[model samples]
Target: MSDDPKQVLRYPQVQAEELADWRFFLMRLHARFRTGSFVRGLELVTRIAEAAEAADHHPDVVLTYPHVDVDLHSHDVQGVTSRDVALARRISEIAAELGVEAAPREVSTLELALDVPDAAEVQPFWRAVLAYEDHGEWPEVTDPGGRNNTLWFQEAPGATGEAQQRFHLDIVVPREVAEERVDAAVAAGGTLVTDEHAPAFWILADAHGNKVCVCTADGREASGE
Candidate 1:
């Protein structure tokens, strides 16, 4: 655990057995529960909401038919903290009471993108820092463990002489639901950054200026769409 309670934990720092079947990706703790029925899922959410209210820590939830996806994080601190850990434990107990099972941790994939003035120079340092394999084919560093997010460096046009966000999140979701996710985010006060590469990836920014990219599997390769 980090010395500071509010400190964001790195991938390796988060222990596997500590999360009670939850997965840690970037700054959030994620768990997808199979409730077996839509009504059961709703019940689970209600219980979770009550628990969150009692604890004063809420999680972002998404319900899709028989599955409920719960994501816990401390947005103010910009990362997962002890608060998330505690809430995850409570969530697991609630899931158990509802007889819901969690999906495997590896079901979710996370990738980190860096906007830098030069990819060549920045890539080497990150590769060394993570002791990762050089996937020269895509020019990105790959984590051998596959537990941490893959690091990709992109060139930021005119970045050398100006200030720009260097780090951001890239969330990979199913292609069929990309549009729905993008629309939901826009409806939640997030501005759409660009859709020029529709069905491939859409960039969106929160009111606080933090940027995130919603990406799909191969919409970018098929028919150059």
Candidate 2:
């Protein structure tokens, strides 16, 4: 755990916890604001983009008429870092200036990640099996109408054997509730694989050896992308 990459701090353990007033959910600093009008939402997006540019950080912005959602995470490190926390505070300030009301509960999204030897070779089978339309670059398939969960394929560690994990679940939850979830899983008899990524993710397994990751914004997604 000590030898692993250094930027994997989870939730309140982050570098700038004091400045980050936004909610941590689904592996990103997520917040939704009621902009009151389509034009207002667009303006808010512009402000956010400018703020992001100044901070040298960017966020995934979902701008719907009268609603704007922003998700911030450090993609390179596959977790939320100090940069995300700082930027989230800036976003909140921008929202306040715009008189936007936060409705973070309204913004939540989940995705499925599958690790395989090669995404290109295995994508077709999963696509056909799930009937999800191919979209974006390699390693992603999505429901056309965005109704069902989106799927992402990742390259597995070479030759994952019986002991290595072949499949796992990444379950995202609000940052504040993360610890409780981990406790429940432990109480239910799951084994903790590692706490090195706590707040980001907790790797655990059931008695039969079926593994699942209770993941959050800081949890590293298995996908390289």
Candidate 3:
């Protein structure tokens, strides 16, 4: 596989059969494998580490008693590349060898969005409080260890109201699962805030009016708003 640091694969380009086990989100390929045991999960992790080392590309891995979550992205390119795809394929093969099944639909990433009138004034405070690192010069802070949800600022009017909402979550998931997630949420008493941006994002609110965005990478790259 060709490794070009400047070449970034779009969502459509990475949606190949070879990468069926992985889902693209927020510039990374995410997959969850059901290992069924801690020892089995560790063995899978070791093999994945070896594969990553051999390919000269590493992925963020989280191991637990019943599963292992893997996130792959080319740090230099700041997005998914052929290298990530190749490694993801290899990781899937390793899981298959160990009889571990992938839970692709269960892979998701969370981000916190804070509604603020002045992003610069409040960004620093949240960064300090959460001890999160800034992503370049963007108005966002992320956990350095990739353990916590990323926090970003969204500019909004400074209007005071009885039902003022200051914060909400951005649940990023695979495009295929976005609708199902929305349906489930709605069935559970959540109301549809808006689907005007369907396939890209859906704004949903709880019974009390707290809002969240169920987002996907689809319709976000090159596609018009």
Clashes of each: 0, 2, 0
Positional deviation of residue 33's Cα in model 1 after best superposition, in angstroms: 0.3
Model 2: how far residue 47 lies from native, Å: 0.6
Clashing pairs in 2: 27-217, 200-219
Error of 3 at 40 (Å): 0.6
Who wins the lDDT comparison?
3
Count of backbone collisions in candidate 3: 0
Better model by TM-score: candidate 2 vs candidate 3: 3
lDDT (Cα, tens digit) per residue for candidate 2, span 1-225: 122432655765643375433677545677788988999999999999999999888888888887888878877775677777778888989988988888866767888876656666555544543345776565887766445687886776563333665566555667777777666666655567787878777776544344666667754455431
Best candidate (score: TM-score) = 3
RMSD of 1: 12.7
| Predicted structure 1, TM vs. truth | 0.51
Mark the regions of model 3 whose C-alpha exceeds 4 Å error after superposition.
1-3, 159-225
RMSD each, Å: 12.7, 16.6, 14.7
Instruction: Compare candidates 1 and 3 on lDDT and give the better one.
Output: 3
Over 41-157, each residue of candidate 1 has an lDDT whose tens digit, in order, gives: 999999999999998988888787979888888866757887788888999999998788988463475677766666665555445434467764576887665446677867765
Off by over 4 Å in 1: 1-5, 109-153, 156-225
Per-model TM-score on C-alpha atoms:
0.51, 0.50, 0.69
Q: Please identify which of the two predictions, 2 or 3, would achieve the higher lDDT against the true structure.
A: 3
TM-score-better candidate, 1 vs 3: 3
- Alpha-carbon error at 76 in model 2, in Å? 0.9
